[model samples]
Target: MAVAIVRNVRPWGGAAADVVIDGTRIREVRPASPAAAGTDGESVDGRGLLALPGFVNAHAHVDKSWWGRPWVPYGGEPTTQGRIAHERAERGPLGLPSVDGATAVLREFLRHGTTATRTHVDVDLGVGLRGIEVVREAVDRLDGAVDVEIVAFPQDGVMRRPGVLDLLDAAAAAGAASIGGLDPAGIDRDPVAQLDGLFAIAERRGVGLDIHLHDRGELGAFQFELIIDRTLRAGLQGRVTISHGFALGELPEPRRLELLDRFAEAGISWATVAPPATAPLPWREMAARGIGIGLGTDGIRDLWSPFGDGDMLGIALGFARLHGARTDGDLTAAVALASAQASPFVHRDLHDLAAGAPADLVLLDAENVPDALVRGPRRALVIAGGRVVARDGDVLL
Candidate 1:
């Protein structure tokens, strides 16, 4: 039975059409049939709003946020190690990594039209997979309205922290889609050992690796090579991602091009939050080389920093402004990176406003894709898995 019909909407700013949903997938999308729209189980008149696939948050830290609580001042130091220590010291007292906190962050995501996300949950000696459990319970609390993929992340140094590798392995065995590493050389000071340990676990457990590489310039590039080598060695191609690889943009053109080729060869993908003042990525070249790029909001209102709101469109806009996107094509590409192009990041084979795709979409009152990308107006409605989960910027679920 058809669950719903979204009437008279412009998909990607195309001609008006009615999107029919059956079960959890789109059944069909054909020319607008206003008369037939009245027969739907749940009929939503789109009012010719511009429709887009539900936003995909490729990289996030849902477990770390303290949303829905009173504002906590940023008390962590500026450096990564300092922030990690601060979080470990302070999170316990604040009841961090609770289901409520994670749920709060996810609800904010849904309210902003994000239907799916790939979030990294901290897996350190202190937390000991408790964060993962919190995130899982939060997802269950939502009852599948938001699809979440977990990456058991070693936010603290993987190699330096004893027993963390075993925890990561345990997480992989317990159904974590991917295991994460953080700054192998900068934090662990042993890039080779850290990468080798992570690769060994990934190969053994048949899981993917999403490593955070914050070491800038040559140091970062060196680790990238090490990761590339290990990715091919372990036959983990197409299952490895480098998150916040700031070095890629900092390198000279030739060096950057060389690494891009190697990254393509290793089937490595990238996830970034597009922080300001950083070098702009060679996104055109990466796109040409078929390298996948995923955008994320990182962490929001956490012990790390008191920023972000879990809005993927705002992150897309930040990416556009950072990359100097001015033309219609570039602007639309930015939005696509936040939606359809990010499908792979969330393990979706396809995610768009078309037949056979998951019935997850957002409707905004805008003229076109570029307009939506630039302004990022409030979502008029959000359909997730054929159900109206949010409307008029309010999360129904």
Candidate 2:
């Protein structure tokens, strides 16, 4: 753990600094000086490289991520409901996405500097927990290369999908990281009962919670309130997340402010995937109010979404475009959303370059992060847990 000076390095900001690392921990960052010392240790030449906290993808579906699927590319040219309908029809019944497909997707993320990701796994009935287990194993196989957090998700209703909750239990027992529920409305005729059951299981298990909200229009009202109450009762707001709560920004102005204010107060964070089609993603308002925000690819290279390239930069760029915000601060905030800070669920200390933090990191081939993200650099060297699992454009290869 002696001094290792990485000189003339471009830290997250554009300013070049002389960074000193004591073993894997970054000891100091200061303006470059002639007297900066480099000791006999691993030397990382930072010239022509950008040093930033490795990117974190707050939300993603790795197993369901498909490439070359029969889906139109993101942003339909027609830009109307009819066009969207036609696009869906063309894609046909979506093929079952698998862990094999996810390998390529994981490499793509690492290749672009996203070293950490929270992936939701499909725990539907017919498939059992095999798909999620497969994904978990793949991520475990990449343990030294990239950080992937798996969520045991019941895409089918927890109550309606007989034995699904039991499957979730088994997943947790089998080392699946978190518990997830999707649209309790899909669970049964009784929405409240379904969600209550799921939350009860989560409460008993002491696992993190991530919920997908598909309630469109008026139906979301009851579902949202119940979710908030359940999270409150669980007393794990710090460990809970709500993905795609799009309707939050769609309510009447006063109502929107009230609920979001509550969301902020509750220690809850929202996962902004498609940027809320109902309203501009509430970026400015949420940050100003201290609400934790994060970004996700949602569905990568799939019929559900063709926008993802397994890159967090793409996720942040989409956020910037959809929200109409631009500034270094905005980019910084966007980066946090893609990092561990984005979710209340993940417990990793992943936002800083420091000693003792796992060497889960990314190196970008650019001058600095803001500009690098703007260029969407493809050259990335990813180190996960002290091993160079991804390098030379074939991260995890």
TM-score of each: 0.98, 0.83
lDDT of 1 at 247: 94
How many clashes in each candidate?
0, 4
Q: How much is 228 displaced in model 2, in angstroms?
A: 1.2
List model 1 lDDT by residue over 1-397, tens digit each: 2357889999999999999888899989999984754434578888889999999999999999888889999986788999998999999988989899899999989999999999999999888999999999999998888999999999988889899999999999999999999999999999989998999999999999999988999999999999999999899999999999999999999999999999999999999999998889999999999999999999999999899888898999999999999999999999999999998898889999888999998999999999888787999988889888888988887
Candidate 2 per-residue C-alpha lDDT over 1-397 given as tens digits, one digit per residue, 9 for 90 to 100: 1235556666665576666555455566677766534434455455536766667777888886566444545544543233334334543344454555677677777777777778888776666787776676666665535567888887656776679888888777777677887777743556787777667777777777788775664576567777778778878676677888766766777877777777776677777675535566566787778777777877777645666687787777777767765787776666656664653435675456555554555667775556766777765556554445566677545
Off by over 4 Å in 2: 1-6, 18-41, 67-97, 186-189, 275-278, 343-345, 365-368
Instruction: State, as a TM-score between 0 and 1, how close model 2 is to the true structure.
Output: 0.83
lDDT of 1: 0.92
Provide the lowest-lDDT 10-residue window in model 2: 79-88
lDDT of each: 0.92, 0.67
